[model samples]
Target: MNKPIGDLHCHPSFKPCNNPDISDIWTYKKNIHPKDLFKGILGVSPRRWMVNLFVKDLATYTQSNLDSCYEGDNRLLFLSIYPIERQFLRPDRPFASSTFVQRFILAQVFGIELKRHIDSRIIQILTGFSSTKVVDYLKSVYDSEYVDYFKTDFSLEYKYINQSHLSCSPNAEDNVATFQLVSNYEEYAALRNQNIIAGILTVEGAHALGEYNSKDLVGDKMIDDLSEENKEKLKASFIRNISALKDKEQFEFTPFFITFAHHFNNLLTGHAKSFGEAKNKSMPGFSNVFNQKNGLDLGISDFGKQLIKSHLLSRHNGQRILIDTKHMSLQARNDYAAIVKALRDEGDAMPIVISHTAINGISTRAKAAERLDTNQLDKKSYVSRWDINITDEDIREVFDSNGIIGVCMHDGRMPGGKFKDLLKSYKKRWPQKEFISKLHTQMFLTNVFHIVKVNLDHIRTLNAQIPIEENRIPEVQAWKTICLGSDNDGIVDPFDNFNTASTLKDFKTRVKNAIDMNFDPLWKRFKILDIKEENYRFFNENEITELKLGLTSEEIVDRIFSDNIETFLSTYFVRAYLEGTEN
Candidate 1:
């Protein structure tokens, strides 16, 4: 096993599984063999299959299961507690037509593989039925009136996290590798010293605040269109949920951050297009069904702004939870950025956060959109140009705010140079060993490389305004902003080579090896920007030379894997902003 590393965002319990103990994470073997399949089909229906001919959004095997995390040496993780948005379940248009169609969409949305079946208890609970049959569950979904289970789901997750903590026996005879939630740096440090993994709670979307209602009415209703009484009720629910989160007596800890927007509009703020075109290409029938682009043009709602100001970003029990800009629409991001700036101007220590994202390599939101309009996938660039990703302007903002960015490991979002085409080619050459590995690893490295470049460029621009005699920003400072936001078990198609949290140990090694093999060629290629590529290059010869001088390959890799996150937490995850008061 390799040394433990940190992950900015992952979900260890989003999948449907049966763990009776509740304190222990369920572990399963890959039993997708023909014999197992035959037995499963005859005895019980399998939820997972070798391939889903109908739906492309197949379930990935457990990526960050506690067993995998313990094995992969992922010691510190910020678990994204997402209450699966209702829009995803409801879908739209064609998907709502037939029962089989509903089942197929449900399988895809829930990430259930054919060889595996969702735990009967879970299915029953989701559908509100006593029968453990899939048909019954579907019937319940279609027949039952709308009911928002967001709060129920959120509370259940808390139970899982808390019980999982209680289950950890780090000092037992087996010395079982396990984790505990750490609210403060001191607790994290203590856990580290004991060789126990640390988990930090983070909410994935503001929608998790509460959205109780029928799937039909609440999934797509804009706040403005809702009746005044309904709007007030929703607001009350949101506030009640927010207050519950602040009740330390119940939750025992505060979430470090809450992402304001996600796949669908929460009526609080709009969201960027989450289900990209590339992903839509996989599920031919469900093209653009999940993204809900109608709300993409909407900015932060008046109510959303108030909640962020009065509840989320405001101090609660002396701990102010930050906001993560991972899935916010450009307009919402802009609005939030201005709010952050204003807060900072008033002497607040708010740090900008973009958890689980890729770099688009474009300078600004408008330019990225222009590039996307012509080149839908932005394959010409070294990284994906999807607007869901962070732009050069976003990177600059992160740097200026002394904030942090978690580079996601999702392949769909980290595309480089006709990445889907490459994947197709790689699939054709399947039996060939290391071919796919080399391809995906390169894609991941490009994202990391571009992030470093963006940070370096930001510093270079700042240095240009100063005297030559003044100390230039050390190039190594560029590495500090990045941490691994793998989005493991978050329904992401991770790098094939680094598929699971267990593989991240190998990922660290691969990163070092990839850097050693490809650094020079990549550096040169990036310097000469093609017409197709955005104007992302901002460093000169002297700056490059200084970067080489300041950090060794080993040092840079180490920072990405663990040290950078530790450093970020040391400064930001403290008792207060006052110096020497981190404890």
Candidate 2:
């Protein structure tokens, strides 16, 4: 029997943006109708099969289609309800006359600026090759007069997912499976036993709590410029929208957590530099597109503080939705962590979550910035050092709170190790089928290694503070916090070998073999660095040797793929036992 896998962050509903009415999750070639062919010619719902076959690296195709997840044995899916942000499609600038021909066509069709507005080169590139449904959807969003487009979009997506399973006969004795959204761990466990693909809801950003304005203002400027009366009105809308989710009609199906920030400032908190590569020389035109300058490094807004204190962190249908600090700016994260700390001090413990993230390999956010500015980061460092990645401080906080870290699988977020080139060269020389799998396996393991190493380092630091005679943290415990959070179907560039959810089953087996074969090198690659003398003691030679052995076990590989996530759910994914009150 194959072991079931779990993805803490993924968007199974994203790729079908152009066709929400579709009955099945997987976009099968047979499902493509004659009308869709006509739509493809018009740049709406383009044939993804062509791209998937010809340009695998393009990654424009859906990764977490329901068919793929069910076939791949991915049972526990923490699906994200990301109300596609309008800012990405319609930015501050207008398009120039000398842009791509497709943009001109799309602009004419949608009656919106195709070039002047679109941010992110990746978005522009994907728009060119894939369906224009996202652009069409965004245009309609702009046309709507509703002040809470986010909530509207969020509800539409939830309903689409909910309705898709209506045709699924749960008791049927066929190979057919359904993606059912579970309320808590109890439902998930029940479904898992029957081989059902269970899904738990999670929103990618607090913007879903009604930050969207229909006026087409740039980023969160509307929030900043809102009149006092309007601010109160928006806040009231926020309360109503959030409350409805916990009402009897939706409580058992609402998101368990909402990511605090995303690509743009959501008026709740500033976000990290998610588009640093756009500023590079190769993408000069995109340098000014994704503007994070206004409140880029600033802390959370007043409205955000109120929302957290009064709604999100409070009881809603006898359960509280957790906050995810994935795209939050450094200052915002620091401020939020302080709040978590304060809550803990007050005898209220809340789990700190970074739903999908990579490691910066730096100790703190400030140090990451300094390293970037001075180009002092280790040249051999494989992981991307962007601020969007979690720092040592974040790992320590999550570890202390017994929170989980779902390491993301985007190539942009977590680049392969320094030996990437060497592995590629070996594959070229060997020209064997297995070499292809081995190459990608080693590359991806680098990311898993970094996260585990950082946590182990944190544990060791804690141990150093205690005397040699005193009890210390077990090194193996660090492995329990790290698990998969592949942001598939979230416009990510996936590794070629493990391109989609269907590839996960094979990837799991490959990971076990790679860990057993490459244990020593991976251990040395992520060796602990010395901390400041005043902060903590350095690891002794004996401690380092013992730590290395503890993490080399094959059990750690299983933990990364499934065990850790299941353990976390059993402990934290539960409703409050007390009598419930409405939000």
Candidate 3:
């Protein structure tokens, strides 16, 4: 592996959603006299990862100071927008049965990124809809009679909209200097090169659709039970009330928003050993007459199945596509497997691969999560969390599907955790058939110290085991996938041992010093910093510069870096979604 390896996941251009902190920071960057080039680049990069720097907790901006320093570079950024698709039977989600209500509530409750709790209330009302509580209240005043007509609530909608204007500024003035942001968004595809990847947008969830023929079913008594603590009760209430609102001629339930945590977690509950049968189709799935038993059945929602089916026809059309099944749940994977077989049966070739993984047969340490101690130090206690990794069965599926799985760096996705624990987590996620605890926010932020530690440990683990180069994680001595996925501009930690944009020289110097000594510079090796310094690469410019294996070889390298992604997009990505592909 002689090349200057790069990564597919890097967000260099992002912006803050309406917090006031940027004004000051921008001012500092602009005005800081005796400007140093190094400081300038470093200063801007952090602002990208941690938006907290751009806004005050109180939501005010320190603008005066920022205007002075940030006078130099104003790079237009390509930002991501979350389309709120999480509500759509998203795969690998633990709490599926409650996702619709939960995600909806969560979107409103914590989606302060786009609007405040109060503002969301207005959008609901003005749009002929309202929050769970308000909708319930309205149901009482208005019988189910006018429910289908959004116009029925025109008076209230107008009143709320008026109130919103009044609250922001005088009714006559639209010049308030307020900045705000949100979740559940749909970013324009054309904005990619602009340096943005607006987060996900919401696609129609199955639950959001009900029988289309019914009319006038959403109303009052339905409102009465809106606040019930019990989930099943709430679900039943929604189905009954919303179902009843329609005219008998038009009423049919549309399964929009989604629901299907329908299966039990046998692995966690001790009903099964590690995910032994974690195959696509072989795992949990819904059996309908349309599915032939032996075909690869990926457990997708009816909507997902359609999407995957369409995706396959449009993109794969017999071309190879690496389907990273990492984020998919057991059932979803199975569903896809079925679909794959069906495609093959029809003489359609579908080449797919699981991008990264490990073996499952290995026992991993418990505290293998990437975590941190109170002192911000890395510790090796494998708590119940961060121990989950891909399993052996997971690998077998990918392999059987003729897929490639990348063994990743960053300690099996559990940073700052012990090496052994990380290994165990990886094994589970890969060739094994069991699942592990997910990495939550606390573990993510707290695990910085362990990242640094694990990299060190990895170096020690294979000091005498493998060849000079492969020993650097990503090899048999150390298999690693692209670890740049969530370095998040080095703002968030657990990559405690990473190189800052500023001290890159020092980091590389240390690695070089150790190269000939037969010791490991583990974490350092995983990172790619300052592309100018090509020597750090196993096969840097010197090795690759003139070695013409012919145009095809160069073409292959080109394909490996950006071309593969392009090919992937050509095979599957909607050109409509190609807006920001370059970045």
CA deviation > 4 Å runs, candidate 2 = 17-22, 27-57, 91-136, 141-147, 166-174, 215-225, 276-295, 316-318, 371-380, 416-436, 464-472, 519-553, 577-583
- lDDT order, best first, reads 1, 2, 3
Candidate 2 structure quality by residue, lDDT tens digits, 10-32? 98875564454443565521223
For 1-583, candidate 1 gives per-residue lDDT tens digits of 1446999998876553323322345352231322232343432334333223322332335677776787778889898887766555444543443356444544553443431233333233332223333333343345655434355567777777777774554334554666678887767877665667788889887878765445433455566556787788778888777777777786777788888788777778877876644233234333334447556746788888888888777764346778999888777888888998998898776789998998777778767656432234565555667778888788888887888899877765667566667677767866364666666666666666667777887888888877873577765687778888989877666776677888888878877776555535544332312222453343454544455446766777788888888988887777575122333
RMSD of each: 5.7, 6.2, 18.3
State each candidate's clash count. 12, 4, 141
State which candidate, 1 or 2, has the greater TM-score.
1
In order of appearance, the predictions have TM-scores of: 0.82, 0.80, 0.33
- Per-residue alpha-carbon lDDT of candidate 3 for residues 492-541, written as tens digits (9 for 90 to 100): 22222221222222222333323222122433322211111011123333
Query: Runs in model 3 with CA error above 4 Å?
Result: 1-5, 12-81, 84-299, 311-324, 344-347, 351-388, 396-412, 415-484, 487-494, 499-583
Clashes of 1: 12
